[model samples]
Target: MIRHIVFFRARDRADVGRVLEGLSILKTIPHSSRLEVTLNGKVDQLGNDVDVVVYGEFTDAAALAAYKAHPTYQESIDRVRPLRDVRMAADYEVTVD
Candidate 1:
């Protein structure tokens, strides 16, 4: 299994909802097994302006790649591109769970 995690820091925190909605579109997709959207909470430890965290799970790398190239994702990019400041992601194979 592959776990794809993404952190999005937006220029405006209010724009998080639009971005989250865009991500929700992928939940109904056939190849996507699991999708989660989280609103980052105010924590003193991490001062990052990251407002949203997206976690996606796929059976394999191919499935992850397909999710990235999906039209729904492209639409998301288009929607959030204007309000985004920076975005970072990491993907790793799940060994324990």
Candidate 2:
């Protein structure tokens, strides 16, 4: 199994809602086994907010890849493109549970 994690920072606070909606679209992909989206609940000491986080679980790297190239994701990229400031992604194979 592969776990793909992502974190995004928006240029402004108004972008948060649209980003969350875009993250939710991942669940629509056929290969997506599990999907979780969370808003950053705490503010940093520097007064910066984390914005959003997405955790997606798939059967393998190919499945994860399919999810990334899926049309829903493409549409999401279009919707959030203007608002996105910084984005980060990481993928890992499940070692134990």
Candidate 3:
């Protein structure tokens, strides 16, 4: 299995709602074992700057790649990119016991 995680920081606080709405499109993507989007609830003591987080689990790299290549996903990225100040993502294989 593979886990894909993304963190997004909005350029303007007012854009958070719009950004979240755009990102919600990911949940409609197929082949993901799990997909979720969350807004930051509280300020971090360490001052972490992320405003939103997207988490997804896929069966394998190919599944993740397909999700990324999906037109809806691409459209979501296009819609949200302009509203975000920074975006970061990571993907890794998960080992099950």
Highest lDDT against the true fold, candidate = 3
Task: Assess the local accuracy of residue 9 in candidate 1 as a C-alpha lDDT between 0 and 100.
Answer: 77
In candidate 3, what are the lDDT values of residues 36-67, reduced to their tens digit? 99897757798778988999999998999899
Candidate 1 regions with alpha-carbon error over 4 angstroms: none
For model 1, how does the per-residue alpha-carbon lDDT over 1-97 read when each residue is reduced to its tens digit?
9998888877777777887776667676667688887877758585856778888889998998888887888887887778778889999998655
Lowest lDDT 10-residue stretch of candidate 2: 41-50
Question: What TM-score would each prediction reach against the true structure?
Answer: 0.85, 0.85, 0.94
Candidate 2, residues 1-97, lDDT tens digits: the string is: 8999888888888879988887777777888788888887766787555688888889988998888888988997887778889888899988656
lDDT of 1: 0.80
**Cα error of candidate 2 at position 9, Å:** 0.9
**lDDT (Cα, 0-100) at 90 in candidate 3:** 94
Candidate ordering by TM-score (highest first) = 3, 2, 1
